[model samples]
Target: MTITIPTGDLVGVLSDVVNFAHPKPDGGVLNCVRLNWDGEYLHATATDRIRAGISTWHKDDEPDDDGQDDLFSNWGGADNPWSILMPLDDAKDVISNYKLGPKEYRVPLTIDLHQGVLKIERSRDTGHSRLVMQIQGVLEEFPDVREILANNDRVKPVTGQLYTAKFLADFAKVRARGPLQLAFAEGLTHITIGKRFVGAIAPLPEDRAAA
Candidate 1:
């Protein structure tokens, strides 16, 4: 299947996902990014068993030749999303050095998945670039992160805690420019800049009173 998305949007999402990818010491799949398409929205997710990040982009409304509303009709059913595991380094290079031209209105980066390989292409009137990389063969499963996020109760009042200064700085570099919200719950702290970007990090352990 071929998926095309705006260069800026793709980069923003990828930058956030890469920050949260910490491989498990026991050799787990948390080191890679999971790309999923449910025939309507494209999602990128990464986790380290403790922290997680999820970024989603809805496909633009473009009618196909048959007057169909969805562009990914043949991709897969909503119940069964099409997914591929991309190594961290490869996923970073996919968007590295990507810059929109001055006259470019909306340059698109196209991802083509076929035969266990993923091809990424970007082109403009001035220049073009492409990268082909192999997807991870091991189907180490990813947890249903979205389900966990949705099930959290938002009615209870949440208390604010001091996040690591270093983490706060790092988050600012990738977070979308605007007001931000932080929520702490169930030993995890979630930071959200907008509806498009969400990231989770483990909260610091509570300090014990002096004896």
Candidate 2:
């Protein structure tokens, strides 16, 4: 089955989540960006256990005239969501190509998933060349990051707590559309970047934070 995502939206989602993805050698499944489609919104998420990043893209209508194959049917039912894990390198490549490629050549990317392999195609108008790339999807199951993302509670505010500076700084890489806000509490530090991206970073123990 195949689905189309807007060029700018793809780049935005990738940029927001890529930094949170861990390296393949160390993190295995955590080194991927999970792409989920629920018949409306397409979400991209990644985490390195300590911190996470998430972004969403909405599709109102199908872009291709042929209609292609139904993503839901290929998986199960419309109510059941479909997801695949893309490598961190592929996510970075997409972002880099979009930024460095000719502006006029930028077009919506078509994602084709089949038989354990995932393919992405970017086609240019008329005389321009098309770019197609394929890579294997990681078969390992991704951790339940939703559980971590939902535990953010700032009700009992705290101060002077220690957090890893590197984790806090990853939020800045999100390229948020609006102001980035951080809500500190006793446990996790909730991060909100614009309206579409959200994340959380675990606080470090004072002993470890000082090192």
Output the number of the lDDT-best candidate: 2
lDDT agreement with native, every candidate = 0.62, 0.70
lDDT of 1 by residue, 45-158 (tens): 887655678877765522112222234323222443467777777677765666454333245666666666666666443245553444443367777777777665253455
- Please identify model 2 stretches exceeding 4 Å from their true place: 60-80, 100-106, 152-154, 208-211
Model 2 is weakest, by summed lDDT over 10 consecutive residues, at 68-77
Report lDDT (Cα) of residue 151, candidate 1: 65
TM-score of each: 0.73, 0.79
Clashing pairs in 1: none
Candidate 1 Cα deviation (angstroms), residue 3: 1.7
Model 1 C-alpha RMSD to native = 6.2
Residue range with the least summed lDDT across 10 consecutive positions in model 1: 61-70
Clashes of each: 0, 0
